[model samples]
Target: MVHLRNRKNNYSGILIAISLVIMITVVSLVFKQIFLNRNNENEQNSVLYIQLLNKAMPVINGINYNDEVDTEENISIKGQLLKLIGIDIRNPFSVIGKEISMFTIGTEDSSENNKVVKRTLFKINPFDVNDKQINKSGQDTGDTENLELPNRNVKVNDPKLKEKLDNSKPQVLIYHTHTTESYSPYANYNTSHKKNVCSVGDSLAYNLETEYGISTIHDTTLHNAIFINSYHRSRVTVNKYLKKYKDFKLIIDIHRDGMPSGNVSALKERTTMKMNGENVAKMMFVLPKKNPHLSKNLAVSKKLEKISNKLFPGFCRGIDLHFNFGSVYFNQDLSNNALLIEVGSQYNSVKEADNTGKYLARIIAEYLHSKK
Candidate 1:
């Protein structure tokens, strides 16, 4: 009987110890949370907190904090609650791809300005490894001589194209398929509107109208918010313009390239051409290899290349052929005159890109006018 009683007492002591430990852990977590909340609330006005807040919620961070929404307050409270339960919600980008639970949580943005983040999308992959390099000059080539090419316009005049060119309405439509493709020098410019590839388009349009009397239309529509479906979205815009305008003779899509070296770089890897002691971004003309009108498109790119190299040596990077028609049709099937031009890599400054635009306008004018 005595041994049984001793054993029971020992069991009771163990149960009590366990209960005390559980109580202490719960109490400690509660106290720590309270402390964290107080500190975060007090230090919310601090620069570090503001910066962290900005980085954490980029889309909605600029809005003024409100007690009704309790955005700032809730982040601290919820974060602590999650931490207490052993969930670290601090680095959301780190956990985004790793944790499946994250998908269940819908991020909310309550801003009066309608500044909402609909979906987290990846930026389009702008680097093309399969691009065929031909007649390469610029900094990489050991030969430091100015580039030169003979006038190679084997001009085959289409009576229909000549007829359309004479129309008073805009004959050339200059739009950006990847409208947000931006320069490294002006990285902070707005992506949703002008100051990116749209700016380059504007410059091209201005030069075309001013120098050559060519009536050109510059469409500044953005189509790459969801990078995966950028081409499809751009087709809608293209179709709209084609149906709306009867005088459209040339359809040009402008974009910039992203290199293996970071978008903005100080290295020689940045694709650039030296023009009159100033560095200018180089250009590439892409042709759809499988297009039914491949011969017609190739003729135009060849003409542009001929004039570009002859006028501004090293400015025109060789023509590239897009093999997979389904992956990137470039809306070439819509019109034989459609040309996709990559202006420069992201590393190039805005000034360099602008210089390319001026030269490009001149080349385009020469090509169009040559048809006469």
Candidate 2:
């Protein structure tokens, strides 16, 4: 009986030791788990803090959108979450590609030279960007246009419309009556219609005839009328010249546009035309839809298109057809060869705008040669 009791005590002691070892092991495991969990939580918070701080940091700018001349560029955006992260919010389409094409009307810098400079971006203006008053009178009343653009309300002037006859080689007769008196209706603006009139008109005719040997007859008398807009002049000038010169191949009328140096669409883009294997000044070719004579404008526009397409692949931006207004005659009614060109704006210096005229002469010379 004594031996059995001693064995029982030894068994009890072994059981107690085993229980203590198990309890110590479980406690160690719990402590280790708690410490590991705390460490992970602290690391996660630190990472979150770093991310937030980086986001709140100000952005550093490199380079800027220059207005003088432009280069084609691109950036991509795929997520709407970028707005919350301080991304640009102006154009959602720009995230995919440039929202405003080369010809979007009403650019920030609208001067003639500057407008020409901006056109290299898209190779052509995406919108019609018409500067000339469009003629919609002949439409069947079933036409509609939806533009993905800004500045839709302003009138579009034709940058391609001829503004001057380069020199005496192509003499022009000025029958202008809307002479601006010395009145500053708006502060700092000279509202004189004939500002730089003599220089622009005389020089243009001289240059064209001298450079290309093309004779231009300047008929200053338009039914003895002096005050005329492009639309009225279209009727007056085109008819008189058409009757006088039956053999003149080209009838060109010159006019200038009035827009802020930077807001007019005519000069925001630069054009480079390859003549004599060199990139020379760029000029746009235009067609009017509203002239009382549509056939004449269409014929001349088509000819210009043919010459341009052959001489310049992407040089001719396009022919615009305005569907709103209509007139009885533009000089185009005079000849199938009639053309209107807009030189650089008044904001551009004479030298800059004249460069465009010189280039046009060169193109015309080449076109005649090709025809011969």
Candidate 3:
């Protein structure tokens, strides 16, 4: 009986030790979580947070196109939230996690001015081996010095396009997937890497209508609350939105690039144009291969690139072909008139890029008028 009782007591002691260990673990986890929420909140307001808010940066720390997060609109909301909570957001891990959850939880602006985001939808870009490159510029991109090309007038709009009944009224679709959600009034610029596109596109549309006697319609297919968005996908959506207007022949998708920027020199550049006292925006045509729909006829894109070269000299960037069409066919397949233009690299000022749009608008208008 004494031996049996001793064994029973030992077993009870073991149970107590196990329970104590488990309780300590739970307490440690909870305590750590509390410190994280408290100290990290201040971290949210720092550069790391500003980075998360940057629209121009597509991937950070190699995290991109997360299914749970709508990177398009995560910035301003995160910024505002962090600001309110006194969070500095200095930690990369915290910034990445917060951005990932922003889309997962579907945070959006609830306002009438921000209606565009509510109207548009986004496709999720999966993480694919094909998507990542240890080096994005790739090998033998060669001295960008090879950028010069001869200019020509290879009509860029749809061959079916005609002079509008009112040539003075030039219209356009000013859009961004991230732009759908409005954290505040547009008085504050929206966070989007495509800002160069936005600024250039707007300037062109305005000039076409105001200076040239064109009817201008600035429309957005996706309501302002759009969380997840891509340029190619948004371009396709814009074409469908303008289908009712048969005269809408020119479909241009404006974009900004991530290349390092400085002076542009070309072996073939011979002409220059100025807008608002700044050199006008320069352009390159983008073509897509592998499409069920019509490919961005390489012939058509190359022809326009050459024409831009001829007129403006060093203005034309080389023709670009990419398979990363993203989720958007870019509706270039919709008409031979469609174009995907990269206005400037991300580092450029919106003012410097403005001239490209104005110059292109003139080219396009002349091309349309000359058709007859």
lDDT of each: 0.62, 0.40, 0.46
What is candidate 2's CA lDDT for residue 330? 34
Which candidate's lDDT is highest? Answer: 1
Clashes of each: 0, 57, 52
Per-residue lDDT of model 1, residues 82-189, tens digit only: 655655575463354335432432233243332222233322233423225555444342221232322222221223222223335887898887676777544422
* TM-score of each predicted structure versus truth: 0.54, 0.41, 0.46
TM-score of 3: 0.46
Residue 278's lDDT within candidate 2 is 33
> How big is the positional error of residue 92 in model 2, measured in Å on the Cα after superposition?
20
What residue runs in model 1 are displaced by over 4 Å at the alpha carbon? 1-167, 186-194, 262-270, 326-328
Give lDDT tens digits, candidate 2, residues 59-85.
Answer: 523222221011101211212224324
Model 3, range 1-372, lDDT digits (tens) per residue? 999999999999999999999879654553343344432222222323334535447654443342213221233434454534434353344344345543211122233441212222222324333324566654433233233343333333332433344734334444443232211112123444234256666777776655544455554444223223345456556656566665354566666543311222321121223433444445676665654444435654665665566655556766665444434544566665566676654334455566566567666655445544
Candidates 2 and 3 compared by lDDT, better number: 3
